[model samples]
Target: NAGVIQTPRHKVTGKGQEATLWCEPISGHSAVFWYRQTIVQGLEFLTYFRNQAPIDDSGMPKERFSAQMPNQSHSTLKIQSTQPQDSAVYLCASSLGAEVFFGKGTRLTVV
Candidate 1:
């Protein structure tokens, strides 16, 4: 298996632009998670999907941040109205029971 695949290892967008990060989980995995990492925040859980269904998103911002698992193979994290504060490394992970695999992550930079 290719493990979890995240496209465009890095992204750069202007403030107010939108950035969408993509993730492809391992085959048959039932759970996926999104996290954001920053110098101050360390790693913060953003959202989670179980069986391609959204289960939690309490850590996500109230506006301009959203995550979707459209199918068993992939998920997407969208960030709109990008700001300098939004610049961080977005990580994707998938799990089967106890074992988990993670992608390289997408580093988003807003200018």
Candidate 2:
């Protein structure tokens, strides 16, 4: 599919381990967003950037969570020392204007 691509549809990590999720946005999109979905929080915005520059990351944890858009084609979200509470469906979305396209997301499970 020509939509956003997120690698490793499902991921399992042990407690205190590390997990890295990858995302490739649609070509020509200038804005990218990272979000986390869970039964408790629903969908929560984690961070976003435009033109590969970080815009806002207010929802991200002050520690152990980070995201980066190193280039136009892709972005990565890394979680260090993952805990069971960190388990969620991480979503990646890209937008050129008001319309945003989303990937299937990477379901992370921390045991």
lDDT of 1: 0.94
lDDT of 2 at 29: 96
- TM-scores vs. true structure, each candidate: 0.97, 0.98
Residues 14-45 of candidate 2 have per-residue lDDT tens digits of 99999999999999999999999999999999
lDDT for each candidate structure: 0.94, 0.97
Q: Tens-digit lDDT track for model 1 on 37-99?
A: 999999999999999989999999979999998889999999999999999999999999988
